[model samples]
Target chain A: MSWTRKHLLGLQDLSRDEIQLILDTAEPCKEIFTRPIKKLPTLRGRVMVNLFYEPSTRTRTSFELAGKWMSVDVINISTNLSSVAKGESLKDTAKTIEALGADFVVIRHYAAGSAKLLAETVQVSVINAGDGAHEHPTQALLDLFTIRDKKGSIEGLHVAIVGDILHSRVARSNIWGLTKMGAKVTVIGPPTLIPQEIEQMGAEVSYDLDEVIPHVDVINMLRIQKERQVAGLFPSLREYSVLYGLNRRRLDQARDDVLVIHPGPTNLGVEITSEVAEDPRASIDEQVTNGVAVRMAVLYLLSGGKDIP
Target chain B: MSLLIKGGRVIDPAGGIDAPADILIEGGQIIGVGTDLPAAKEELPAQGLVVVPGFIDLHVHLREPGYEYKETIASGTRAAARGGFTSVVCMPNTNPPVDNKAVVEFILAEGARNGAVRVYPIGAITKGRRGEELTEMADLAAAGVVAFSDDGNTIMNAVVMRRALEYGKMLDLPLSVHCEDVNLAGQGLMNEGRTSTLLGLPGQTRAAENVIIARDVELARLTGGRVHFAHVSTKEGVELVRRAKKLGLRVSAEATPHHLTLTDELVATYDPNTKVSPPLRTREDVEALRAGLLDGTIDCVATDHAPHSRDDKEVEYSHAAWGMVGLETAWPVIYTHLVLTGCLSLIQAIDLFTRKPAELFNLPGGRIAAGQPADLVLFDPKKNQRVTEELLVGKSKNSPFIGQELQGWPVYTIVGGQARWVDEIGR
Candidate 1:
């Protein structure tokens, strides 16, 4: 149950036993949030730095809150707020941070292999918040945690992931994580938005979200950027929403207990309608809540927490 | 000063000879060859080595004058010598582009001044390689340019390409083309396939290369100008060239060692070293390129020896420069993967490296005979060479073949009767 890896760059390299251990660890961490006194001294003397090259409000804040709750000191170094804007390399910046006695470094970069690059550059335990269209391990871990918590087990579940599979790091991570845990993953998107030969990654590809809804135990909607529309991958937002958007009308086709998840901030009325996103079956808010717990479990285990109950 | 290369299996594809022989060199030319030749001051005993007429690389980028930080005439040719090349035809995609006589003369002068091997300059097909305007083709040809090319960029306009071919036909020079339609290829970092999909990187379809080859073949047919497709990578691209050849069009194609050995799967790791123009293809394409070489479809093997600085390659896959330094690793990779694997005979591989490319440019030194220039390489075909950064002779060590344990190491690279590079172990 002890974490041996110094880095969590991607879920693609993680083992099934290791993934289960992380999900199990996050369960106890989630229970603490339900209590009135939600703080822990697990990493009291530890220092964590969130070095994000890309802008993020949710993931950064969640990791900060997770660290603060564990009594760990957290620092944020975003590109615009630091000397990274002066064109310093990730290597030089990470080395400077590591030299400052950081115990852990959480990085989100616009380059696919930046997290792995930083991991090789520093001695500190590195965690990938997100790296280009590569992976978002904690997001996928929280997603799996939410799915398992709601449905009782991960095995024998059919999960349909809709929207821009080509550019979704979340989809990449989820494809690796969910498939490792025995979930059959169906990636539903337009042909332009779906990467070629994604089936090689152990997932089925589909263009019609409507036809795929009824059979899946879970549907994770990835955010469709306005930039993708500007890049001319699809015709228009209206057409996209009409064709692939999940709404109340489309929700009726799914099983009553089918879970809807979105890695927000959502394109609200485009990929998913306001009605279905706010529906009780939707696990959007729960995913955000579990994100904090999942991050805490990652920090705790990477900081030398033994596998003790 | 004179030298004698004694007792080696000499392979001269153009001369139709592959036998144990002795070569006597004096005044930078072959004076005699056969058993029991007259002795010289310097004797290189090549008992187990295989000797071949100097390897001629038809496509190489000696990034001098403008991008000397990447490579220079001195360093690039030295690296070429280490790779067993006795001569390399420099591509004209330099900063000022070898479009005019001035640049062409400057390249020739620089090569004469610093080159370890014979350096033949290829003039730009169009002015500045922009594809809009044509260069002074007649003047460039008179300046001793072996061929004309805008190697890093394609002539997209059909009319311009046709005109260049017509003019080149009049001048009796080959138009070496870097065939990839930019419109179809668009910002694609790797080959379009399962690997590009799994990695989420943009993919360039094989048709990007095939379409242009098809167009150029027709242009060659129309003008009767010799068209040499540079770094041909796709199966369909090779098929087009093959069909063009069958129809008796003046078309020839060259394949790189990378395209013959590697696939787009290497791009899955996001290694920028694997990023190349006409991007590395699938396994089927590699086999097709190998088969093409064996069946006389691919005329030669050229190391599109593009050298880029460290910063150029140490970036995101999309932002990384599009090339790999092939001159140093070309023979070893080709020998290990193709010849040893029984895909091509040793003489066939030597022909692709020497005679075919020499015939393409009509250059000298593809034949090892009396009175021919003493441009040759003594190769240890079974010698093991592990590619490493420190072992690289070029200024830019951007080869993807690093860490590969390859057979066939050149023991002596003699250019103009002088030893350019001699393996100390062989001594």
Candidate 2:
């Protein structure tokens, strides 16, 4: 029922039960994470690299800390400054990483199947950190861990993944983890940003966030829907917030126990209000804690808790 | 069951017949297609039905076995059903590929077991669709392969393609090359045009597609072999094919439904649905495709019905895959754009959807004839409506023509005398 070592990929279809297993596993790992001289032999002498082509400070740092706590050597490759920036193909970059004797690669490329591409090319294990908004398996697993630690189980959670879902690898990841964990999810956003087929993965599709917020146990807001403005996608950010954003008033309308979350570098006052993020009941910090633990489990499992070959 | 298709303008282009035909079907065969020869025991009475031959698509990517999330043989053949096609030549792009006899047999077995529509597996011209070396064509054709194509990718080496054509001539099978010179298509998101410039993304030029067509046609002449280009989009490609036919080169081309209606103007929208391979061309090129479709220079209108999951499609324009879910929209859009524009008659236009493609690819079952398998479609052309995701039947919904009002809609799709999908009462 628990994750031994499966790389997190797209959350397009992970059920609530499956997500709960990772979450439950993360709770004990969280205790292991918070202790002084936080290090474990579970993954000693194993190596991992966080190759992020896209900037995800919260995700990148959490995975790094997780690997470090697991006593695994972790290297952070900023895709912006690496050979990737120098026009190296993903396969070439993967081969280089593999050649470095790294056992696991946590990649965040800007192409949907970049992780799969890297995984296919490399002999080493590949954990999709976030691939071109394709999937962010670790993020979703951590989100599940947080919810399960706070609420005890994900099965009856009534989770809502709202905003910029079409562009957020995090949304895709969480969908796989949360749905498999047994939570009934409702994806809330403009029809344009929320793709048409998420419901097939067992989530309810909603255009009006106001209608679904009251019924949700957790409201996870993706980054405010990004726009180049000329792509004919989103019109106004101010208007997007008006229709779907979770604010202080909006939170009050929900069940008092309902949790609010932002994957972070929060768009404050856009996807959510400062007040809601700062709320004592908000299990947001716990998610960061769970993120490290979940990633440790991932690294340990992907590396098989062993020394280099 | 006996049937009398009562007040319908039956257009059999192959039979050189165009008039009201009260067709009769019995024992799974079209016993009477023209004016009534004998009274039938069971008369459904097709009152004003545009009964043409059951359609066959020359090109379709029924991604089965490996990439089933996109489309399976069962789902893809179902999509063919919705498109009013009774037979679909499944491209050789399956997981293990229909490149050899064993793969061909497996595909045929799966199609026979699950496909509502007749599925003819097209063997790969090369092993694993890598286009490095040609497959054993004589063996594949013996295994009942309809044709040969490295559909998803082109035969990059002209020498390899010319050899493929030469081998195909020996087997009498056409080497259907997906013509795209990687050099021209490199770093391209959509077509090289105002839209790509506006989007600030790399653009794939028509030269990417055109140069290959011209080179291949010349090669076809040199080799004295047949070459059929799959999904021709560029004007130069069509013009080359047109001239090659005139120059006594045994060459043919199939234009997809998207190329006829959608211009590269759509990629301007930056929606992934508008993003397609040989990326929808300029307005001038679209007009050329439409004109070619009418004049019969373009042999058949095929649906390069590529289905991608939501996650697969919901990305930046440059990063997203180049295809759209076109099975459901192909007929409606073709009806709205070509048929309504005086470009073709209802009879001639329906041929592109039905019999013409069958004749082009040498596939049987395009027409509902005596002793023929009962592959037919019952359509209601007057029902015009906008295409919404809600109405789509396929597993994925990534279409660009969601809001446009389309005139021609298939109400009841019947393949092999079996009703696969029937429209609701209100529809």
Per-candidate RMSD vs. true structure?
1.7, 17.0
Positional deviation of B396 in candidate 1, in angstroms? 1.4
* Candidate 2 ranges beyond 4 A from true positions: A1-309, B34-41, B425-427
Query: How far off is residue B274 in model 1, in Å?
Result: 1.9
Docking class of 2: incorrect
lDDT of 2 by residue, B173-287 (tens): 7877788998778766677655543333456778999999989989999999878889999888888999998998888888988888878777644577787887888889988
Worst 10 residues of 2 chain A by lDDT: A300-309
Give me the candidate number with maximum DockQ.
Answer: 1
